[model samples]
Target: MATVSLLDVGKTFPGLDTPALAGISGSIESGIITGIAGPDGAGKTTLMRLMAGLLRPDSGGLTVLGREPLTAPELRLRVGYMPQKFGLYEDLSVLENLTLHADLRNVTGKERTQTFERLLAFTDLHRFTKRLAGRLSGGMKQKLGLACALLGTPELLLLDEPGVGVDPISRRELWKMVHELADQGIAVVWSTSYLDEAEACDSVFLLSQGSLLFSGKPKDLTSRLRGRCLHLGGVEGRRRQALATLLCQPEVSDGVIQGRNLRIVLKDGAARPDPSALDISGPAEWKEVAPRFEDAFIDLLGGGPGGESALAASMQPRAEIRESLIKAEKLTKSFGDFTATDHVSFEIRQGEIFGLLGPNGAGKSTTFKMMCGLLAPTSGRAEVMGIDLRRSPARARERLGYMAQKFSLYGKLTVRQNLEFFSGVYGLSRTRQRQAVDSMIESFHLKQFLGVTTDDLSLGYKQRLALACAAMHEPDILFLDEPTSGVDPLTRREFWNHINGVVEKGVTVMVTTHFMDEAEYCDRIGLIYQGKLIALAPPDDLKADVASAALPDPTMEDAFIELIHRQEAS
Candidate 1:
């Protein structure tokens, strides 16, 4: 058994005014799974890295497995760490990666073989044993990373955002593996953005901007939302519109839109919609609903009622579809005989913020790359702004903005320098470029960091700069791939504000994300599983459809879980 504790911990990055871990304190029990969850900019990664001995706290004591984490050499043998970005050599085969880790950890032949076999079986990676680590899908790579971390069977495991970008099925499988490890008496401390995943932890530490907010079991969090939730479902437009509209209402405190339905927690559940509620076009579909962990989280975060005025967008003017913002028909891509995308078809409407959702390796990136003309498809067509992606790649590319998942900007460049570089590429006139850069500096809060090099900025700040650059071009559509990964909750919220602002300005947005909560923000979503789209609809509709087939009071999370299980069972 291994115990971890942080007592009044604090860490202030050199040259930064604020402390990343401001007098934080938490503990993890031996032989159980512990979770730390928060928005982007939260000190979750900082705290976990502190415990892993990657960074020393500026103040306070940190102990792991009865030793000082920062100075305990013996502790390394008992502690395994999987970073948010696992640095596996892309050129190495899966087996080679495992072998490298085994050698580094000093595992002998028999122990290595046994551990590798069990891990491969547990992660369902047996068939891809010979594949290059880089060739594997995101979820598979994550599992491979975990396998490396578990090679030594350390007493304590520290994983940072381990499930980010993994598919629903892959997430479930990963959790099952984690639970099994804990059942065998390993102490696992995992960080993630998914509240449902957090719920499975034996205990959780909720952090925000370097401060501990809540520490307790999942039930404790849910208990906070008791009697505050209501569920609604009906015709497509009415349901989504109602949910979206309700979110802006003062009486409604936090809501989630799931395919033609709404799950809301009101300040007063007893309060009813006004009798003279504006009659919308769809059927009169409404109901009182049960609350889930997510509802409780939104409520706790002070999400006010989403009433009629709050959702005024239902009455907003509609626009004609601009000629082909993005078009894909029967698009297919395959590696060997395994299809990554098969006959995928969709047209991204102009000024729409479309979302692509799927488990790891579901071909979301492949689809995104195809549209960007970065990768050629095995079959079918991909187009952007009415220009063929393959035939006139550069012509189609000029009308789009893309933000890669990781920092694509040069680390050595100052914030302003990066902006200037991008502005030049966008071909803005000198006057226009100066104006755009100035506006971005103010809007993105990058003024203070104008001269700071990219490598010196925090991940959240770097992410903001990246988004700012992508938007500098003011393209008709923006493609964001897990843009908010590893960011703290507060920063994630701030990021979404910018995204929502862009959408409000009628700029079409296409995004891929690991956070399910973010999925609710999308006008429409495509659920991809194993390289195929399993479901495509508004969030409320997907939830309502699942609810119709579920036992009474099933939640969106439940519906998603059930849907995946049903697919697997069949």
Candidate 2:
């Protein structure tokens, strides 16, 4: 049965020329996960709000559970909606928040008690009921929010990017719980920027710039690219260079580094070109690989930018430095009796991309904060460019650049204003600031958005502006904390391409991310768990350590989960 239906729905916000959602029509049925996916500002949230009856369409019709959601007050009672930022009071205990939501939803008496017990058990959050919501891990908080939303026993559930920032193990657990809910005949509508999640759904609606591009099974879209996907082998150490060259080719539509090889998609019906013809050095082999949902999505979006990073090309190369640019020597941080970072030690050399990966509350962020001089360590030292962070944090920071997980820029400021402000903060002279801002506007393609406020820019453009601000100072070292958290795959590729270009110019990078595939791009990875560094190795070596007879070729995620499980077992 169709739980929600849209008939040529259209929505337009005041003072905006373009409609947020235009002529949208789709059916969300019961007992299955219906995925709504698109890039940033693709009307996903708008459509979801319309279904939840939070906003009424300006044109066309929308029905939820066989009733006009805008006209039916009771429809809200039978529908549960979890927005991207779920409202769970940080100061309240998990149990208290649940009780509050139950009261608001009018769940009363014995029924409330029964619902609380069932939800706590279902989300595996019973053990932490007394813990404050702010103290819970990213995954735990998500579960708490879900529990609160499910309090009214709604027939339909809406989740917007529920897996964002969640580690793979926790994401897997959440997926299991959601599937179990669907098994109980509840309709699930999951909106996400992760294409892999969309591929897992029973059906998907792909939107772009306020239009419905595709609505069907993910495999049905993936099958359209059969025989077009190929894995270019023998790239090995030169994979990034080869990928850069391959992307410039007219025949290649999309390409990315996969472990030690380059996975690429040729334009539809385009002849396969030889590696030598594309100017890739040495012997290379091409093997046909299965098409992924991302490939098809990018294809539908008119393919990715088919050239080297323009942002990288505009920057000047850095002077050669043979020593470690960043070093954390026995770093330890503790809040009272709880240790957040326990004796973590690592060194990042010049031009190397070092990754620090861990589950939530696993000490990665603590170690990062200590290294960046944002937090004082209980013991040991953090040295950047041979200068101690504790003794001279300002000097150390002057030589480094940091892009936060949330893109910490003034949202109300315009693009030009943000660039000018960051330039001035970096201590550029008046003339240099003007030069830098002009160069950034041109390189990042922000000229059109110069007058637009940061709050109104698309996520992709916001990311571009953030990178521009971080790199405009031409710092020797860069720190990225979950830099690609909630963006789509295409934007992620673009961001990495720029990072690769900068690394080639002798910029050292220290990054932390939950995306295991992105981990493949790192030179070496340090796995932190329970406030201790558990594993440190190159990406291929890490995967090889966990490879087994049943799983001859383990992925980065597989290695990560296995290593963490092994540590816990020990």
Best by lDDT: 2
lDDT of 1 by residue, 1-570 (tens): 239877899998877677788887778886789998876667788888898888888899888988897677877778899998767888999999989988888887788888888888988889988999998877888889888889888989999988876766677778888899999988899997666677778899877668877888878888766777766555444344445556566677766554345666778454645412744445545575656555565566666323332111211333556565788898899989889898888888766667887666668888888878878899999988788887987776677778997679989999999999988776766898898788778767788999999998988899989988887767777899898876655466567656655565566788988676677778787776667777878776777677753466565555567666676787
What is the overall TM-score of model 1 with all chains considered together? 0.83
Q: Give per-model TM-scores.
A: 0.83, 0.96
Cα lDDT listed for each candidate? 0.76, 0.89
Q: Residue 209's C-alpha lDDT in candidate 2?
A: 81
Clashing pairs in 2: none
- Span of 10 residues, lowest total lDDT, candidate 1: 306-315
Task: List candidate 2 stretches off by more than 4 Å.
Answer: none
RMSD of 2: 1.7
Q: Could you tell me how far off, in angstroms, the CA of residue 106 lies in candidate 1 after the best superposition?
A: 3.5
